[model samples]
Target: MNAGKLACSLLLSLLTAQLPACSFNMNVESMLSPPRLTAEQEQIYQKLQNSVGSQQVRLKY
Candidate 1:
């Protein structure tokens, strides 16, 4: 029973240690303003917006 408990605790600790590798940090700036597009991207975006006509279109990267 004691060995089983020890093994469980070790497994839990190892999982906890690995959790940060799968975690991500949020960028407050990006959330607020988002990144700008390159010239080529801008042309494509404009084309998309134009294709949509008066309706609203949004692009996210």
Candidate 2:
């Protein structure tokens, strides 16, 4: 292969290798404002909080 083509291939392979290390989090809205729970769910959540320390539990679904 020509030098220019070989350089391009090398750069492309390097970029492709880095793809798996990249991540994109699209759940910004959910993280910013979690959904509200129903009455029964809230009761259960309170019980969980009481069982475990409040700081140790985060309901993410």
Give the winner by TM-score.
1
Which portions of model 2 show Cα errors greater than 4 Å? Answer: 1-32
Clashing pairs in model 2? none
Q: List the residue pairs that clash in candidate 1.
A: none
The stretch of ten residues in a row with the least summed lDDT in candidate 1 is 22-31
Q: Which candidate gets the maximum lDDT versus the true structure?
A: 1
lDDT of 1 by residue, 1-61 (tens): 9999999999999999988896555888756877899999899989999998999987757
Q: Give the TM-score of candidate 2.
A: 0.42
Candidate 2 lDDT, tens digit per residue, 1-61? 6999999999999999998896778787756966799999999989998988747887778
Backbone clash count, each prediction separately: 0, 0
Task: Count clashing pairs, candidate 2.
Answer: 0
Query: CA RMSD for every model?
Result: 7.6, 8.2
